[model samples]
Target: MSVLTTKEIMDIIPHRHPFLLVDTIEELVPGVRAAGKKCVTYDEYYFRGHFPQEPVMPGVLIIEALAQVGAVCILSCEKFKGKTAYFGGINNCRFKKKVVPGDVLMLETELIKQKGPVAIARATATVDGKVAATAELTVAIG
Candidate 1:
């Protein structure tokens, strides 16, 4: 079961179709953590040019998905509601596996630190229980 559908996620984040990566949020704790999923399909816009022969989900997009999950966590808070979370920075990022069509990317992010309008989170993306990517993200709310 999902805690937030794509529509609900859109209500929280300022992302639209062809750019919004997360399909469903399964778990969430305002200002703390979130878990979401993205179903990879061959029809995704990026696949059209990213490698016509053997399409692969972009590594940056994996991090963006994680950031979006973190944004949902932060933006859902009473104080931060209606605010935008900008990417302050990305640290210690690593990609372990290639995500492809038919893969369900399971994304998780935990808010590790926050000060004033800036925050940090530990993020990870997986497919079939295997790590696809991991990173530390810095976000600034405005």
Candidate 2:
């Protein structure tokens, strides 16, 4: 229906501060697909320790960003409202480019399968229409 803001996401997922990778969800279709964004900045906490001399958003965080998008897809369910969605596992993850400060990452996710409380999703991160990273995320309603 409508896009979700950071506050709404905060209500659905338990992530906060540096751990919350997604800024806003642009589109959501519950059991089908979703899209979101995160604006990387030089002020991000991870960039400080990820590299002191040359700041680079860690590949793991990038995957986490994609997984967070998947989280949004699963939590779009009404039954899961006010519940915490945790990343159960990740598979087939690949990084094609390095994400740095000032990059606006676009996260896209599609629901692949689900069994009861667990769901699997395929996701990708892009910038300027180029793939930055991709992953298969598994989430559990907790």
Candidate 3:
């Protein structure tokens, strides 16, 4: 079950189709943490040109998905509602596994430090209980 549907998520974050990587928000604690999922498919836009014989989800997009989850965590707070969370930086990013089509990617982000308009989030992406990627994301609320 989803605490926030795709439609509802759009209300909190400024992401749309194709670019809207996150499908559902499973758990949310405003300004603190969030968990979301992305249902990867073979027909995804980038899969076409990325490789016809073998399609792999782009690492950057996976990182973006993690950022979107982090955005939801930050923007859902009452004070930050209707705002956009922009990436200040990404650090210590590591890709451990390739995310392929048909994989249900689970994304989680936890706010590690926050002060005023900037914050740091620890994010991770996984599939079938296996790690795919991890990063330390810095964000600025706008």
Alpha-carbon lDDT, every model? 0.96, 0.88, 0.96
Error of 3 at 101 (Å): 0.6
As for candidate 3, its clashing pairs are none
- Score candidate 3 by TM-score against the native: 0.99
Lowest lDDT sum, 10 consecutive residues, model 3, at: 49-58
Residues 1-142, model 2: lDDT tens digits: 4399999888877789969999999999986799999999999998778898889899998888888888888887888777777889989899998888999999999989999889999899998899999989998888
TM-scores, all candidates, are: 0.99, 0.94, 0.99
Worst 10 residues of 1 by lDDT: 15-24
Decide which is better by lDDT, 2 or 3.
3
Task: Please estimate how well model 3 matches the true structure, expressed as its whole-model Cα lDDT.
Answer: 0.96
Q: Each model's RMSD to truth, in Å?
A: 0.5, 1.6, 0.5
Candidate 3 Cα outliers beyond 4 Å, as residue runs: none
Those runs of model 2 whose alpha carbons end farther than 4 Å from true positions after fitting are none
